[model samples]
Target: MKTLKQLLADKPKTLAVAAPDDSVFQALCVMAEYNVGALLVLQDGKLVGIFSERDYARKQIRNQRSSKETPVRDLMSARVAYVGIDATLEECMSLMTEKRFRHLPVLDDQGQVLGILSIGDLVKETISAQQFLIGELERYITS
Candidate 1:
């Protein structure tokens, strides 16, 4: 039952963001340079939407839209799935699976973003938790 806070503390915070008015290319470049799958669309210091690689492929490439001239608002996922700092790992997993989204923006109670999590991050945490549980059970049996 680890919380998002613990995960964020264990992993340093890194935010990738772009203004709502920014071009899709700009956000895409930021994501690529950061080696991340998503970008937070910010406007007036508020989280407006999320632009993911999947959005680029589906909305831009598949649709034959021009990434160079397209706005992220047109391609970004507006109703993104998110988690709060106090949310349990289970909630995060459920939201991601239900939404079919690979990344989720973690926000504070005030809607201020804390950090982002990827599917890989969740998987790694799950593996770590399983390992710890196994070790604890092994020690209990040995004792």
Candidate 2:
């Protein structure tokens, strides 16, 4: 099983972040610029919560709140689901599915943010691994 460390290594090193005091519009601009669905909410370089499209739609749009006036802390999901760098792909998939989360923040032992993992990333990696395994098995049988 591939670990999150390896998976993260394969992805871009940039981590999208937004300040807790930032307006929801500002966070959404970051998300749009990065083409990401979420941003890790940080305060003084510490993870506090996550702001996603879902959060914006559910908390802001539905409530008729102004994105420019609403702070991310007001709409961000405070109880975030997180994973460690050493965690396996299967573990991440399981957690994401169980929690109905699209993204998970990857953290270190010191509780420092390393990267973020999306469900799409997990599924793509899993499919690629499966393809490699199947190709190997087919070659072995042919030999």
lDDT of 1 by residue, 1-143 (tens): 46788777776566889777788888989998898888988888779999988888888865555777788899898887788888888888898898788998888889988888888888899999999999999999999
Clashes of 1: 0
Error of 2 at 9 (Å): 1.4
Local accuracy by lDDT, each model: 0.85, 0.91
Candidate 2: the clashing residue pairs are none
Which 10-residue window of candidate 2 scores lowest in summed lDDT? 57-66
- Off by more than 4 A, model 2: none
Q: Write the per-residue lDDT of candidate 2 for residues 1-143, one digit (tens) a residue.
A: 46788888887888889999999999999999999999999988789999999998877866567889888999999999898888888889999999998999999989899999999999999999999999999999999
Best by the lDDT measure: 2
Q: Against the hidden reference, what TM-scores do the models get?
A: 0.91, 0.95
